[model samples]
Target: HTGNEWGTENRAELCFPQLFNTSCKKPTTPLSQVLLFHILMPSMSLLTVTLNLLVIIAVSHFRQLHTPTNILLLSLAAADFLIGLLFMPGEILRNTVCWFLGQLTCSLYNYISFVVTSASVGDMVLISVDRYVAICDPLHYPTRITERRVKVCVCLCWLCSVFYCYMIVRDDLSQPGKHNSCFGECIIFVEFIAGFVDLVLSFIIPVTVIVFLYMRVFVVAVSQARAMRSQVTAVTLQLSVTLTAKKSELKAARTLGVLVLVFLICFCPYYIVSLFGDEFLNSASASIVFYFFLLNSCLNPLIYAMFYPWFRKAVKLIMTLQILNASTYK
Candidate 1:
């Protein structure tokens, strides 16, 4: 009777009964929750990938799209694309099922996740700086923010993300599953000191830089817009055209400011949770916050589609395969 009960328990709970004591238990989730997650997570992943891919193709295939600002955006989209394609699916699977992939795969996934996220934050900082220069120092913007310099900055951002994440997770990389307690589980915990450092570098510092720069950009942009409106009413035709261009730049800055604001709203909750410790929030609630964070990637391209006329044209061209024509770049 005891043997039969043990077998039933194993069948019901353990992910791998053959491994018995070493195996992890299967996650117990309600039918409604399971169905909801299955539908919701994959949809988020697909939308994120599809939307960011459009941005990637738009920036890469069109010669006219290759500017300093768009280059930063291209790098940002690439990181977001990876998040949707790789990290989201893995996160969904990890939460829903026993991890069957070996420990090394788990370690690498976490490492890449950190790298991509750090790169995304870095890209936002660069975008804010780009807008600040364009708005506050219009005369030098052309010479100061060139495509080559932007490309170099983007490359450096990615490299630093890789290096920084490696340093953070070096022990885990050296010995995969060192933090896991069972065969079917995958978990990594940063030490208190390391976690604190990560909080400052990854969350605090970047957010501070972004907020400060955008504040400056906002002030300058608003003042410039008011000046342009006033001058347009009194200026000669040549000066009127110049004011018109400045007004357009201010509009662009405002749109991108919206993007930055959305990013902060989505991002802050997750980091705030991290600061307090995951134990403070229930698992389900924490997962919801995380999904909200992931939702930003999907929203980004939608923002572009709504605000940028060029992105719409690029998508139309890409959909029709018109980009294959030799003169499409022209």
Candidate 2:
């Protein structure tokens, strides 16, 4: 909301200086910060797109990798891929400079961002439930979480994401850029009540499900470890087994530590700020926070795909061109 008077004749400083009081003044973002973002964000986006692409390819191309869990990962990786491919570059432009793209683009941007983010969240909940069932109810896991069921659930997740985000951004779509206080700035303001409901339904409820399921999975895993420990016969053998088991438990604890830390670090601030109002969403600092939240999408492949040995093998095959050669020979 800074004045064009301070901006002088600098069209660079004000998005549209000729409009005077109505023009959106660019935030006093430092050159170094903007330059750094210009360099880093695209690189992050490229890496995210590449890694997630590999995950998608690996899952799709290999028969051995076509499991229920991999299907969910593939769905999540696609969501991440879209974020990297579409949203990150757009955010770099929209946040780092004046948005010259106009209101229609802005509306579409917000809508797609919401849909992708919602799908990503839904995929996370699915992954958690998958793990919970696999670990806590191993016998039923095969029957309960078949590939057909996972595919159907994935399709439903995307469909629901599209429908739900439409509900959130419908008003803005009906009247393009209604929330923008000044020309050239892009902002989407959900009604406070609508935003609150979105917070509850899209974020809070799903995150609670993920956390609870993971906690339950953790408990089941621990109980299984104890059961294994109890099965050891000799005292010395039990001592050795106990030490190895303790090490494994410690490793699992560290992984869970990373999971909780990443979840809280990536998600909490964005939603916490959202809960207050879109006023914060309009601020420059909050744009940075929004970018930080988007960062979780980039990290997701690492968290979900990198842990699996099959993924590693798949990557190796793809990278070495073995898969291509195999296809050619076939």
Candidate 3:
């Protein structure tokens, strides 16, 4: 029982003064850390929620934006929104104060965390597959990746995530507080095998699929670019239109490649720590990795804002409160 079993503390203050003998010491969170948790976390949460909500509104409100690819963005935005709305605040609450939310709430928090995370990962994989089809097999993409099929895949992704993560956290969900060693703590302890399986299914394999598909996509995209460039002098109006369309697809693959890259940068360390035994599971470095993982949700919408003109237009309409009166963004 390193000090971590009690949430990053090996200090003097008792978490529960009433049960002096059994109570763990509360961690002395620094003023900077407190300010960070108090000020920055809420701001991050609000920004995440607000930006992702704009994505949702933009994609859903504008019928012109309802392509299969945007549908996947909508799903990813939904998961990021939940992460901001629920998960970030939960971490802030548990860290800055006592776990007054109770055991059932904690279990639910962890459960939803897993579900949202798995779904986010699934969305990334789906996005990769979508891009792969769009770039590698462009002629068939329209028929292959219809809005209906995207919707079905989104639904199945969520269902499978729900079922799979349930198997991982079912014990804690049932027992409620089985993982907590003392009061004022909300701990998540998954079995080694389960954690490894999660690392493989949720992190490793999906990442492998995303990387591989995106690699093939980029290679094909680059080839398309070279072909278009070589044929630039002989371009007819129709060929120009065709070239422009291909360039659009290439740009999309580039943007989503950035998204997947950011997701990997954020998620890799967390799973890397998990790849180690339980000894490193609750360490301070692991805590940092966990925070890094959570930051991905906040950063995602920012990437959308940077890359997507529609996201910018939507944010403008949303901020001006004109979205209510608008018919479509375009």
Candidate 4:
């Protein structure tokens, strides 16, 4: 009777009954929860992929859309695109089923996740700086923020992200599954020292820069808007063009402000959870917060669509396959 009871328990609990003693137990979630995740995760993944792809195509295919600012946006869209394509699906599978891809694959997945996320954060900082210069120093903006310089910055951002993430997860890369106690479990734990360093580099520093730059940008933008409104004179061609340019800059600042604000809203919770300890990392609440982080990649493109008429027009062109024409870029 004891043998039968033991067998039943193993059959019910173990992810692999054949390796019962070595395998991790399957997570026992309510049927309703499983159903909810199935519906929610896949939908988020699909939307993230689709929306970021549109941004990529819109920026890349249109000649008129290629500017220093859009180049920064292109880099951002590329990082978000990778997040949707690679990380989101892996996360959904990890939560929904057993880890069957083995330890090396798991380590690689974690490495790529870190690289893409870091790149996205770096891109946000660049965008903030771009807007800062455009709004705060409009006379020098053309010389200061050129496409060639922006391209160089974008390249450096990606290269640094790769190097930084490798440094963070170097131990996991060297010895995959060292932290896992069972065959079906895939886990990576950054020691407290490493986690603290990551918190400083990844969260604390970037958030500080973004907030500071955008705060300055907000003050300058508001003042510029008021100046533009109050300085109305006879509509000479030069004055008309100047007012139009100021209005455009103000609108751009407001849109990118929304992007940065949404990023903070989504990102802060996950890092705050990380601050508590490694124990919180594996909890169900942490999983939910992690999804919130991933949700930012989806929100970005939607923000673009809402704010940018060019993005809407570009989407229409791409959807109709009009971009395939050689003259579309012209």
Candidate 5:
């Protein structure tokens, strides 16, 4: 019934992979590529979905966890949630060589993917900027980047994201053969520009700013730690007791340093691949690089677990409660 409907056919084909019996024709894909594209993709899709959802629940259930930093985390979790729930599943289904969800759903799917993913990346950049301000400009940080500024930044991020998504959706469905399967095809100019912009604004610019700000913070903090150690020695000599002076400051500095390092590890791969693909790689290579972006969602929760004690505690508690509840019901 939907031979010309790319969206519907694509979703149906992917959702029920066994049902789609059409095998490859030209230049058969290698077994390794098949495994990577079909099996690994679906597994990672489900894993990413579950992890991101957990992040959302972990943050949401803990009322004490509603600081500005976590608010940004929550926003990121939301973005990842949409990508997992709506985009990955839908796109995976589409990849299997059919579209079964009809034209309207196809358009909506594309829109949600762009908007949610873009918003998530934007949130990360904003968070880095927030940390930079907090660390490098401590005395005036509160005044410079207030609660109101955060709210405005978040609001504007979503607004711009929605606008970008709208453009994509419009471009998808507004073509000459609106009902044809090809309408679901990506817009190259839009995607290329978007990728370039995201690579710069989302990762490069933010990281540069973060590095510069943290360098200043590092120097100041090191000096302060030395001064604190001297003061502690004077007091300890006077009273003949030990003090853990500057311990928390040193810890905080180390934590921030580690955080920047992890952020670099998680983001740099995707952007590096992105820049390389845009400049020289073919479509297939670029597509693989694009999938690497999903790895960030997987790594993000891990980062939070490593760095945030509250997040780790909440995850453990929630898992325990679920286990007990399941046994009780059993």
Candidate 6:
């Protein structure tokens, strides 16, 4: 028996140390021990979750802020919010003890996990596609990215995610006492299908499109950089030649490139681990990695606030309005 068979199959059944004892077999406890780790992990999760909720509610309540891009952001917030609320808390509970809830709760947990995860993946893909259109086809973007089209796209994304998760949830529900065992295993085929879909839809498709789009973006950037450099060089030939345009364009391109690169760097490891089924096969590391991926949701709002001018302004405006309203009432 594994050292961590302390929980129900449908829920986690052990504490963090017990669950991960095997992974840290060589380690001796430090002064603080696992206490610090536990506190920090849950705190981070809560912080990210609360911020995401604030952003989502703030955006939803403001009609002037709604747009095609914001719609995708709202969808992403919804997915991330559910992930933090429904999934993470249950997982934490499971890890610390036996499954307090029965099969019904277990099924709901699994279903919500599947749905939110799928939706998050779909939102990433949509954002990538949206960026490609905005950057590559600026002139036609207004016509292509209609509000109705975005709504349809968001709806389809949810539908596909729900349908994808349904099979797994249904399969689990079909077999009574199937999850009664002391493991989190679902039907093997269901696991297989979920894994395959995750690989294809989340890892494979999004990465492919993002890579291709960024490649084009780079080429265009280089071409534009060269043109600017050439013009600067010509002017410099007549003057001191100290000032440069190539360097500035290069800086902007590099900044955008780095942002995209950071996203991939942060996310790629989890997906790579995901591709190997064994990583998540009743392993405690899977839970940790799952939370690591969820960190991206928190990172998303930061990304938008930093990189997207409109989002930054919107956030600022909302905050300003709230402060004024509070002051006025006071």
Show where candidate 2 strays beyond 4 Å: 1-22, 26-28, 232-261, 304-306, 326-330
Backbone collision tally, model 3: 0
Give stretches of model 5 more than 4 Å off.
Answer: 1-29, 141-149, 165-170, 176-211, 214-282, 322-330
Give model 2's TM-score versus the native structure: 0.84
* Model 3 Cα lDDT, one tens digit per residue, 60-174: 9988889999999999999999999999998887776677678899999999989999999999999999999999999999999999999999999999999999999999999
Is candidate 1 or 4 superior in lDDT? Answer: 4
Q: For every candidate structure, what is the RMSD over all alpha carbons to the true structure, in angstroms?
A: 1.8, 5.3, 4.6, 1.7, 7.6, 8.4
What tens digits encode model 1's per-residue C-alpha lDDT throughout 1-330? Answer: 699897887767888888877889997666756754688889989999999999999899888889898899899899999999998899887778899999999999989989999999999999999999999999999999999999999999999999999998888899999988888876656666777898899999999999999999989877887777667667588897788778778878887888899999999998888877635432655777887788888888898988989898888888898878833454
Q: In model 6, where do residues sit more than 4 Å from their true spots?
A: 1-37, 183-190, 224-263, 278-280, 309-330
Q: Score candidate 4 by TM-score against the native.
A: 0.95
Candidate 1 runs further than 4 Å off:
278-282, 326-330
The local lDDT score (0 to 100) that residue 247 gets in candidate 2 is 50
TM-score of each: 0.95, 0.84, 0.92, 0.95, 0.69, 0.71
Q: What is the lDDT of candidate 3?
A: 0.87
Ranking by TM-score: 4, 1, 3, 2, 6, 5
Q: Which 10-residue window in model 4 sums to the lowest lDDT? A: 28-37
Q: Which candidate is the best by lDDT?
A: 4
Find the number of clashing residue pairs for candidate 5: 11
Q: Model 6, residue 128: what's the lDDT?
A: 64
Residues 1-330, candidate 5, lDDT per residue (tens digit)? 666586555645352434344322122345545765687767777777877777787766766665566677777777876776776666556554445555666667666776887787677667766665555555576688765677788889999989866764565556422534243332222356666766666667767876776777678677766766677647446333323424543554566466556656665776686576433432454546556666566666777778778777777767787633422211
